[model samples]
Target: MSIWEEHPLARRFWKEGRADFPIYDMHGHMGSLNTIHLARAEADQMVAHMRRIGVKHLVFSHHHALFEPSFRNVRAWEICRNHPDILRMYVAINPHYPDHIREDLALFDSWKPFAVGLKLLPDYHQVPLNDRRYEYALRFAAERKLPVLSHTWGGSSCNGYPQLAEVIHKYPGLIFFIAHALFGDWEGAERLVRESAGNVYLELTALPGERGLLERLTASVGSERLLYGTDLPWFDEYQVVGGVLSADITEQDMRNIFYANVERLLGRDW
Candidate 1:
């Protein structure tokens, strides 16, 4: 066998000719990312991708929320409800609509167990991470003990990781997931996540085939603070999961990244 093929973790992962652990995709989208969109028939592609990849459950936000801030989350709730066995919803928030924010938070509170967390697309919406409008959502998340996943790039725009740093420090009790940090600025993401409180985490999605990005993230934050994500429908599911499986880390770390860490965040097994 080749050296990589002989590795113990590889053997276990591929012993049955597939991944050994149940995959819980922490990042996924249920709809199109556009002003105009297709119907549910097109969006079911996300469901098909999950089933094909053996993804047991996925946490997703509908792209409809990016534009239609008022009713998109309720639509997302319906999508998750329809696929209750395999899906959890992230209540999408747009800080631009302060009028709708309260009702949105109420909707999330009503969803309770079905609402896994909150999703903020500051990069798409161009809202600042430190914007006062986000406080209500953050406070609701803190009260509910739910995680808040936000779009984070590298530079110092309102949506950048630097701006998120301010929010992270302000609410140490809230768990923050830095989505797409891998594809943004790996070094800056690593530094920010490493320096912040343990409540901050980085989700591995939309990542390049860099030699040591995963290893460096594991080293900086350890496995418990890292999550696996596919950004499904936007990217191939197997490709994203395989990136973590191929990382040069121990089996325990692999287990954590693949399932355990997100399970801990969700407070239950999938």
Candidate 2:
């Protein structure tokens, strides 16, 4: 049996620790490692996995190689549309691909789901954050009121954190979701949140295994600012989810961290 089925969390639609919780996995990629593209069945398998893990909804993003502007966001959109209640999407626009941004945004506007937000990966795409190329994307997102979720962590030796920090300062109203939440500078994330007056979003995907981190963060920032994500195939499973909820947080806080918070932020009941 799958872990979600085997665990007690599966028996209850909502845990006491997390009263009437509705899970919305806010981050993940849909493609496989061997194939350059995401096959339809493979994408379906991802949804099956989410279901098995009790994830009611997910905001699926595209892989970095597929983050082209000229092409349609078909893969991401298909996954979301296929499982309207189980998956949602965000366009991962490559800032360097200036021509594709408008088209991609138009597609997004047309499809229109919960649309957790935009996905940006400066390290994977080899572009430093705060480059002028992203200004258009940033400005566009700001205009649309779309949030930007960046895949930033320890591997980067560049100015990603600082440049992204600069972007935060540049656009006071732009909601930037910092994925991996500064693996290299966790404290820096805390400082940025304090300074930004809570305009910044610190996504927690890498710390589920470490129980203490969530508790520390919840106390520091108030669980309302944190969003639940699994980063998909790379880190999808109940062990992580359980560890995250099982951390030193009340079931109520766990429900907020895993469900209600994202629901409210993304403006969706499902």
Candidate 3:
């Protein structure tokens, strides 16, 4: 009965009584899961409830394309083009691909999504972040001022976080947001936050209100480096934002977490 196994991702909304809030589900995948599975149908129905609950947006990555550059970029474009209201896509670079950034940036130029960014899921892709193969993609993104969301978990072990760290340190100019807020490893994420300072950020998706996770991070690195994300369908909105809203933070902080940070990162007012 784990979240991932039993759809542990939906526990907060389904079980924690948070079905009413509008959820941004900053992190979710667009697929037939909702069409093929009854449980997923329930999840799709939950989207209307998300609107009621204050969930305004969903920043999604094509889970199937995370490992394939061409397919990932193409599918991401189609999805965003079709569902501009609720879904925005962040393309994944198969770093090893010949065209890399150009292949996707061309799509962005034509598609003009409200928010265009990148998602790197090194664990699933079996790529190492520090492998030096992603330099071109990272450099190109930095030059364009595009935000790159890297998958990091205290649990991801080696995958690509090392490369992610290297990319951040090397580019410094890139808007790098680490998803999963250290992936349930508060200490490691905190350390990265302290080290990155303002150069990098962390997304509060699965981490939610991990005890003193936010407080300690705020104290050390300032709350500005934190981005609010729900990992929708993966984590519950009520559990993610409720305790966070009640925490010892400011209205400005709340605003930043809810929308501003991501808006600023994506260069959009929303």
Candidate 4:
């Protein structure tokens, strides 16, 4: 065998192929422009790409649904139902719609059988990370033992690790996923994971330019607290996949970051 073929992670990404180590995509979206790209068509496209690259499952939240809330959630629910084995949902929560918070949580809870977690975008909504409104969803997730994925940036005014720390402290039972590795604050993201409660996990979706980030994070925080995700429709999957595949970590660390950590959040045996 060639030297490259001898490396476990290299073999998984190149030689051995998807059959042996299928990827579980932690973040994705159903194309928002339903008129031009229908939900089923978007689902088909996502599935085709997954098959092409050996991804067996996807835990996704719809882009439009994240903003539209109730209306698009029903559409997302239907799409998940159509591809039950391959697709899962993240109930999108927008704090701007405070009146809809409780009602939307109830609806999302009812679909708990199909959802993997909840997706929050405080930055997009122009809401602070520790806003009182989000506590509604946080409380719900804690009670149900569901994970929450929130958009996090490094130096943004509202939604970043500093604000997120408060939420993590308040609800220890709820697992919090810091989205996009602090939106490129690799070191800060690692520190957040280090200091936060066990329930907090870092989502690894940093771009390729941030070289050695994955290796550093794996060393500092260990792989158990890291989860792999590709902010799919907004960012190319190849970039996200390449970031992890190029990391100078062990095959087992790759396994933990790519799949095992997420399964842990879902309370599934890995």
lDDT of 1 at 14: 58
Question: Clash pairs of candidate 2?
Answer: 17-251
Q: Estimate each model's TM-score.
A: 0.89, 0.84, 0.76, 0.88
RMSD of each candidate relative to the true structure = 2.8, 4.4, 6.8, 3.1
By TM-score, how accurate is candidate 1? 0.89
The numbered model that scores best in TM-score is: 1
Identify the runs in model 4 with alpha carbons over 4 angstroms from their true place.
1-4, 16-19, 33-41, 267-270
lDDT of 1 by residue, 206-236 (tens): 7624578878878877888788887766777
Better of 2 and 4 by TM-score: 4
**lDDT, candidate 2, 120-237, per-residue tens:** 8787677787788778778877777687888777546433567767888998878878887776576777776777846787788887778488888888877877888887756755
Q: Which has the greatest lDDT?
A: 1
Ranking by lDDT: 1, 4, 2, 3
- lDDT per residue (tens digit) for residues 107-209 in model 3: 6656555446777766655667665667766776788877778777776654434555666778878878888776666666766666673768877776656
Instruction: Please give the ranking of all candidate structures by TM-score, highest first, separated by commas.
Output: 1, 4, 2, 3
Question: What's the lDDT for candidate 2?
Answer: 0.70
Candidate 4 scores a C-alpha RMSD against the true structure in Å of 3.1
Q: What's the alpha carbon RMSD for model 2?
A: 4.4
